[model samples]
Target chain A: MSTGAKKRIMREYGECMSDTPPGMKITFDEQNMTEWEILLDGPEQSVYAGGHFKLKLTFPNEYPFKPPVVSFKTKIYHPNVSNDDKGSMCLGLLRPEEWKPPNKVVAVLRLIQTLLIEPNPDDAIEPSIANEYKENRKEFDKTAKDWVKRYAK
Target chain B: MDPAGQHRDMMYCHECHDEWYRDEHGLTCPECGSDFTEIIEEDHDPRDHDDDDDDSMPDLEDHHPQHPLHHHDPFQPADDPEEGDISRLQWRQVGPGRFSVTGTVYRTVSPHGQGRDDGGANALGGFASILNNMIGGAARGQPAPEDAVHRFSYTSSARLAPRDAINPQAHMEPVDEMTNVLVGLMATFGEAPGGPNAQHPHGHPPHANGPGGGQMPFHPILALLNGMRPGNGTMGDFVYSQEGLDRIISQLMEQTQSSNAPGPASQQEIDALVRKPVTTEMLGSEGRADCSICMEEVNIGEEVTELPCHHWFHHPCVAAWLAEHDTCPHCRQGISKHERPSNTADGNTGASGVNNHGQMPGSFAMGDGPANDATLVQENWENSGSSQQDSSSGGIGDRIRRGLFGPPHR
Candidate 1:
C-alpha cells in the first residue's frame, strides 16, 4: 500500500482501537492491515461471567466512510446476539446512521463492553431466549450462565 | 238621464257599420267614424245579436223578486208562496239597457242572544245558513261549491254543527269509551303509590330506591335480577355478599386510576431478556472461518480481502457481494467502490460517493488501485517534511523521522 493510504489506515485503526477497557484486548492480525482480533471479558454480575469472548473485525478499503464488520469467534449465549456459535451481536450503534466517522475505535469497543452489560431485548436476534426472558427470567438466567461457563471460554 | 242606458246606445256595432259603408273588407264604426279593426279582429260574441233579436224578453221589473226599491202589496207578498217560502231573486231591468239583482236576506241572532233584524243581521245569517247548509250537505254526501273563493271559505271556516243540531246521542258513546281507555292506560303503567312489589303476594323487600325505582324498570341490573333464580336475591344483593371478587375489582380499578406503575420493560430488564445462546449460523458468513466461495479455510490459506469498514469475505466473495450491494450487510456502512475525492475536480463532491447514475460501486472496488500514484505522491509529500525533522519538533515528527530512519533500527 502507498505510504499515505497506509498512514491513513493506521491513524484510523489507532483511533478505533485506542481505549481498551480493563479486561478487553484488541489488535490487528500480524500479517494483514485489514484484519483485526478482539478479546472481551464478561461483564461483572452478569450471566455471561467467567467467559472470554473473541471477536473478528474486518475493514473495507473505504476506511472511515464505512464501518468495520464484527462477528464473535467465540460461542456465547445472548438474546440480542444471534443464536449461532459465532457471536453475532446485534447492535444498533454499528448501523450506518448510528456510526460516525469521528467515532474512535475505542468508543466502539467500549460500546461492545456496555452491550455485554445490558443487551437490548427489543432488538433480539434470538427471539426464543427473549421470549423466555420475558416469560421466565430465572430459568433464562440459569441457562445463559451455564452456556457461558461451558463454551464462551 | 240614465247613465247605463246612454252608455249602451253609444256603443256602436262594427259589423253593421262595415255593411252600411263602402264594401271595403276593413271594419269601421258609423257612429264614431273610427276604425273598428281591433274589435272586429277578435272573435265577436254572437249572443249580442241573439239578445237584439229577442226584444220581447221577459219584463225584468216583474222578475225583481227582492228589489228594495220595488213596491209589493203586503197581501200579495204573503200570498206569493214558494217552496219552503224562499223567494229566488230575479234580474231587475234597472234601465232601458241595464240590469241588476238582489239576494234573499234573513235575520240572524248573536251567540250572546242579541237579535239583529236589519239587513246586516240578514247578511250574517245568510253566511251562517250557507255554512250550515254546506255541513249538512257534506254529511249527506251532497256536491259542494266549485268556485275557488266559495270552496276555500267554506272549507276553512265551516265547523261541524253542534251534536244537538245533528244526532245528539251519536257523540256520547265514543267520548265515554275514550275516557275509559285513557283511565285504563294511565292506571296500567302508573307507579303504585306505595311500591312496585305491593301486588306480589309473597312479601319481598319493597323495590329499593336503587337505579330502577321509578322510570327505567328494565335496567340491566333489573334484567339480571329478573334472570336470576327467582328465590335468589337480585344481583345487587349477590354483589354485596361476595367479598373476594369485589376486592379484586376494586384493586383493578385503583390500579387503573393510579396509572403510575413502572412500565413492563426497562433497559436492564430488556438486557436480561436477551440472555440466550447464539449459534454459528446466526453470525452469518463473517463467522465462518472457511470461505464458502472458494471452499477453503478462511483464516488459514485463503487470500482474503477485508473491507476498511471491518467486514471480511473472501476476495472473490466480497467482489461478488459488492457488485450487488454497496453497503456492508452487518454494519450497514456504505462500502462503495468509488472514494469521495478530496478535490471537486475528481468529480466525487458529495458525501454520497455515488456516480452520476446514483450507483456506488462496492467497497472492494472503491480506490483506483491499492497503490495509486497520487496517494504515493501525497505520502511522499507528508513524509518528506517529517523525515527531514528531528525529535525536538514533535512526537509525530520524531516518529516519521524514525520511520524514514527505517530498517537500520530493525
Candidate 2:
C-alpha cells in the first residue's frame, strides 16, 4: 500500500474501533490489514429481525480514493443485492464515481442498515424480489423472513 | 408573389428518394415511412411537372393520392422543421455569402454568431456573384463566423412558384437563393470565355459586372451556407454544439494549470543546499541509516545534507525537496531557518518553536553543527519578540525576536 493509504487506513481503523455502529461489530483479519469482517445483526424493525448476517469488506491499496468492495457471506433475500456466488451488494454511494475520500466504513454500515429497513424497489438488481416488494408487499416480507430464518439463523 | 401552386415544404426520403408533404405523414415519408426525410422546398417540384406529363412517371397504382386522382394543394406552406426544438437548431445564417467554396478544400474550424440579419440589404450583387462562382483555388484559414454553421438543416426553403417558372428571368435577382448558388458556382468554377469569377477582382469581366458593378458581394459561405453540405440530416447534425465549446476551453485551462504547479527546479538551487561528504564514521547508532524520502541506505563517500532537525538525506533528494517545501519530509523539521520570506519564515518559526511544547528555538536551528551567527540569533530571538518595534530597519536580532514569538500567534 502507498504511505498515504496506509496512514489513512490506520486512522480509519482507529476511528471505527472507537465507535461501532448500532447492531454491528467490525473485526480486522489478523494477517491482512486491508480485509475487515463485519458481523451485522439485522435491525429489529426490519423483515430479517432476528437474523445475523456476516459481511466482508476488502479495501484496495488506494482507500478513500477507491471505494471498498462489500459482499454478504451469509445467505439473504433482498432487492439491490445480487443473488450470486460473489453476493455483491451494489449501493449508489459505493459506485466509483460517487465514492468520496471522506466517507468511512461506518457510513457504509449505516447505509446497509437503512437499505434493509427501506429497500429501493425501483433500482433493483434482483428484479423478481423488487417486483414482489412493489406489487405484493405481504408475500415479499414472508419470503424475506423465511430466507432469514433458514440461512441467517 | 403568387402563393397558389407553389411547393411550400417537401420531405426527401433517404431510402426511396421520394418527396412527401410533412403535414400528411409527419417527419417520415408516407410511401416508405422512413424518418430520414431531409426537409426540402422545391420551387416547381419536378414531380409536379412529371404529373402534368404522365408519360414521365411510371405509377402502376391508379388510386395514388399524390397523383391528379387524389389531388392535394401544392401551394401550402411547409411546417417548421425545428418548431418544437429551437435550441436543437445549432447554426444561424449570419450575413449570406460569408462562407465561399475555396476550391474543393472546404473546412470550418470554429463557430461565430454575428451580423446574422444585416446582410440582406447589400445581399448578393452581380460582382460578388461572379466571385462566388470561382471555386478551384487554394484556400487560406479564416475565422468562421459563429453566428451559424451547417444551417442547411432548418431554414425556410424557397419553393418555386408557377409564375416564376413561366417567367424565370423576371424573378432572377442577384440575391435569390438560386442565382446566389448559380453565380457563386459560376464565380467558383466557371472559367470560360465570359469567366466573370476569374477576372472580376482583376477588372477583366464585361461592362455589366465590371469594376463599377454593385457593392462587393459576400461569398457563398456567408451568403448561402446551404450550398456547403447539401444532404439529408437527422437530429444529431449539430455536432460542434455551444455546450461542447466550454468543454474544449476547460481542457485548455487544466493543461496550463498543471504546468505551473511544479515548475522544473532550477540547477543553481540544487547546488546551493548546505551539504556534507558522507562518511562511514558519521553513521551514528541513534540516527536512521536510510534516507526517508527514497528509503535507500546512505552509501559511504556519498555527499549528504543533515537538516537542522538532525535528519540526514541524500543531497540530490533533500535539495530537490527543499527547493519546493523547505522542510524535512519525514519529521516535518525546518531545513533552513531564514531561507523563506519574512512572512513564511515566521510561520516556520511557529512550527520549530512549538515542536517541543513551544519551549525552545535554540534546539531546532542549532542541532548538530558548530555555533555561528545562527546560534546568536536563536539566543535573543525569544526576548526580542517585537523585532520591528526594537529597530527602524529591523536588524538581525530584532527579526530573530519576531521569528521566535511569531510561532505562538500562528
Candidate 3:
C-alpha cells in the first residue's frame, strides 16, 4: 500500500471510468479502491446472453508488478474459470508470469468478454467443463445457459 | 542406588566437567560454582549405549539414510542447503572410498544442531572410514559398522555455547574440546583404537593403556583435528576438479529458483537505461499520458527512462520494476536481450491514447488468442455496430474478434 501503488490504482480507476467495457458497470469505493465490484451483462453472441454476472477484481500490494486477481462472484459455468467458491481465473494475462505492468483493466475486461464469447478449453481450470465443451458442445451450452438462469439471473 | 523412591536427576557442569545428581545440590554446580551447567536428562550415560554389543549397530542403521555420506547420487543436482544447515566442511574425493575433508571448524553445540547438520556428520563419516581402514577393515574379525555416530548421543547434551555467542578466543578451545569428543567417540563407537580400557576416564574393567597403541592411533586423528582448526589453510583446497565443483554450485543455484519468479536484475542494468523528457509525440492525442508503473501523468519536460525496447516510464518507476524483474513492463522482452529497434517504430504505442492498451499482445498469449485493447472495439461500435472502420487500427478490432475465437463463429 505504498503511495505509488495507491496512485496507480486511482489512475486505473479513472481510466476504467471513462471507458468501461461494453455490457459492464464498475462500482468503486474511495476508501477501498483495491477491490472493485463489477456487474456484467452477458454478451448477445454468447450462450449467457440475458445473464447478469457479478465479478470481483482484487489488486495485490505489488500492483502493476503483479497481476490483479479476477474472481466470479456469481458462479458462472465456464471452462477457463475455476468451478468452486474461489471462482478464480488464472489463464492468459491473469497469470503472474504472463502479466505485464502496462496492461490495463480495460484489457482485462476485454479478455473476460472474449473468454465468455468462446471459452479456451485448452488452458482450462475446469477439466470436466472443458471436456464437455470440446466433446459435447450441446451439453456444455445447455448447462451453461441453465446455470446462468439459476445463479446469474 | 541411593533411595528407592527418590528421583535422581544427574547434572553436568560444562565449564569444570563436574557431574552431580541434581537432588543433592541445586542447579549451581557445588564443585565449580559455574552457572553453565546442563541437566543431563538421560539416566544411562551415552557411553553406556556404546558398550552394548557391536553386533547390534541399530543406531547407525537408523540414521544412515539421512546422512549425506550415504547419499545415493553424489553428482545428482541438489537444492541449496538451508542457511546454517552446515558450515564449512567440503568433501573431496581422494580415492575409491576415501575423502580428504578440508574447512575451518564447525561446532554443533547449539539446540539447532538436532537435525541434519552435514559438517558434524561428515566428520564422523571421515572418522568411521579412517578407522575402518586401520583395523584391517574388520572390527576384531567382524565387519565394522559404516557410520559410528550412533554410539555418541552427546549431540543433545553438549551445550558448549550457542552458535552466535562463540567469541574469537573461544574458537581454539572448541577444536581441543571437539578433539576429546571425537577421541571418546572413536573409542566408544569403533573397535577401540587405543584398546578397550584406555579411554575410560572413570577407570572401568580391562585396565588403562596397555602399550604404545595409546598414542599411536591418536597421531592421525590429531593431524585431522589440527587440519580442522580455523585459519588452518595447511590442508589446501582438497577438491581435485574445479569444473565438477562449479557444476555443483551452478546446479544448486538453479534449483534454488524452484518458484516461478525469475531473479531480480542487477542495479547497473537498471541504471544504464536511457532517459528522455516527455515530448509531444510521447503523449496521447490529448497531450496527456501517465507512466504505467507509477500511474502519474507525465507532463512535458518531466524525466522518463526509456528501456532498450524504446518503451519508457518514470526513471524511478521503471527502475523499481526492473529491480524485481528485468523485462520491460510493456513488452515482456528482457532488457538484457532486447531486439534492437525491431518494434521501436511502434514503441510510442504505450502513450498513443486509445491503442496503448491494444499493444503488447505477447503478454496475453496462453494457447488462446492474445488480448486486444477494447477501446478500438468501443470506437467501432460508436462509428457503426456492424460496418467495419476502414482505418488500419480499426481493421485490427475485427481481427481481434477473429483472433479471440475462431473466425466469426456466429
Candidate 4:
C-alpha cells in the first residue's frame, strides 16, 4: 500500500476509535493495519437480537479509492450474507463499480447495522434464504434466530 | 489359480500381439512385458464359438460396419458411391461440452445399399433442421427452434449415437448453399470483431465474410472448417456429433453483459476538472472535513480538484479514481463530454487555464446555488442509483445486496 493509503487507513482507524458505531468494537493492528477485526452485536430490532457476529474488514492496496472487503467470520443466517464458509458480503457500495473513494469505513459499519436491522431480500446473495425471508418470514426469522443461538452465541 | 483359487482370464497385449493366461503371466505381456493388454472375455472370443463362426461374424459386420475390425482406415469408405467423393462432416466432442467439426472425404468403387442411404438421409435431415432453426431464428430475431434446444440438451447421449447416423452424402443437392449457410451461421455467433472481446484461440484474426451484422465476426469455427480439405467436391455436408451451438450461444450471451459495463473515463475528461483551494464557505457548518479519497484534513487554502458535480477531492486522489470510472465519487454524475457549460459562466470561460477554474456549469449555475447544492447532489445520487440499477444497484447497502446475488437476476 502507498503512504497515502496507509495514512488514510490510520485516520479512519482513529475516527472509528473516537466514535465507533453502537455495539461494534473494531480491533486495528499497527503491524498489519490493512485488516481490522470487528465484533458486531446483532441489532435489537432484528431477528438476530443478542447474537454476536465477528466480521473482517480488510482494506485493499487502493484503500479509500477501492472499497474495503467485508466478510462474516461468524455464521449468520441472513439473506444478504453467503451461506458458505466465506460468508462474504458483496452488495451495494461493496461492488467495485459502485464504490466511491469518498465512502468511509464508518458508513460501511452503519450499513452493516442497517442490513442487520432489515435484510435487503431484493438484493440477497443467498436466493433460497432471501426467498424464505420473503415468502416465509416466520421460517426465516426462526432459522435466523436458531443460527444466532447455534453459531453466533 | 495356484494361490487365489480363481479362473484366469486370457489377456492380449496390443503392443506385441501376444496372448497369455492372466493367472500365470498377469496383465502384462509375458513375452514382450508390455502393459498395453486387455482381458479377453471367454464368451466374447470369436475362436471360442467355431461351430457357427461364419454366420456370427457376418452378422457382427452387418450390425457394426464402421467398427475398427471392419474398416481399419477412417478415410476408407464403408460402402461405394457411384460418382465423386462423399464428404462426411465429422463432429467430435473434443472436450467436455466443446465440439469441433471437420470434413472427412473418402471414395468407394461401387454404390452402397438402401440402409446406408436411409441412415445418411436421417443424419442429413437432423443436421439440416438444426441449421435451418438457427438461421431462421437469427434472420427473424427470434429464439432458436425448440428442436435445436432438444438436440442440444441430449448432445451427450447423441455423442453415443450409431456412427452410421452421421453419413452426410444423402443431401448432396444443396452442397454449395449449405456450405455458405454453415460458414455464415458459424460467423454470426462466433468471436466479436477487433475489440477487447475478441479471443481467437488458433491465432486467426476474425474473417470478414460475416453474412449477419457486425456483431457476428468469423471465429475459430471458420478456422476449424478451413483446416479441412473436403476432397474433389463442393459437398460441405454437416453432422453435429455433440452440439456446440448452445456453448457458442451461451458465450455470446456472457459477452453481452460486460459489453454494456461502464468503461473508464477518457484522459481528456479527467484533465478538464477544475482545481480550487479549500474554503470555509465550501466546508460550511463543521468548518473542517477530510478529503474523502485520502482521508486527510483539507483546511482552508489547501488545493483540491473539483469535479463537474461540485464534489471536490485531492487532485491525485480523484484523478486516479476517474481513470477507472467516469462518475463523480460522491454522486456518480458522469463528467460526460456532452455536458455544455452554462451561459452564466461565460465571463469566466476564457481560453486561459486559470479562467476556467471557477466551476463547471452544472449545479453551480442555480440562483440558490450553494444552499441548493446539497439537494442537487441528493437528486444526482438518485439518478446514479437508477442508472446503476440497469447494471447493478449502487450504495453500500444495495452493493452488498447485489454482490451477494451476483449479476442482475435477469
Docking class of 4: incorrect
Listing candidates in order, what is each one's chain A TM-score? Answer: 0.84, 0.95, 0.98, 0.98
Choose 1 or 3, whichever is better by TM-score: 3
lDDT of 3 by residue, B24-52 (tens): 89899899899988776534343233324
Q: After TM-score superposition, what is the CA distance of residue B373 in candidate 1 from its true location, in Å?
A: 35
* lDDT per residue (tens digit) for residues B1-410 in model 1: 12345322222244443222233333455556676533321134332454454444335324434557344333321211122333343334444322232223221112322221234323333433343353242211111111111101000011111111001112211111211211111121121112234433344553442221122233333333332323222222222223544554445434443221111222332222222123332232334343322223333333445443333444544454344334332222233323222122123234222221111122112222222322322232233223222211222222222222211232
lDDT of each: 0.38, 0.46, 0.55, 0.55
Candidate 1 lDDT: 0.38
Candidate 4 chain B minimal-lDDT segment of 10 residues: B145-154
Clashing pairs in 3: none
Candidate 1 CAPRI classification by DockQ: incorrect
Q: After superposition, how far is residue B100 of candidate 2 from its true place, in Å?
A: 32
Q: Candidate 2 residues B189-232, lDDT tens each? A: 21222332333343434223232222233353433332222312
What is the DockQ score of candidate 1, to 2 decimals?
A: 0.01
Report chain B TM per candidate: 0.13, 0.23, 0.25, 0.31
Which residue runs of candidate 1 sit more than 4 Å off their true CA positions? Answer: A1-8, A15-18, B1-410
Query: TM-score of predicted model 2?
Result: 0.32
lDDT of 4: 0.55
Best by TM-score: 4
**Each model's DockQ?**
0.01, 0.01, 0.18, 0.19
Runs with alpha carbons beyond 4 Å of true place in candidate 2: B1-410
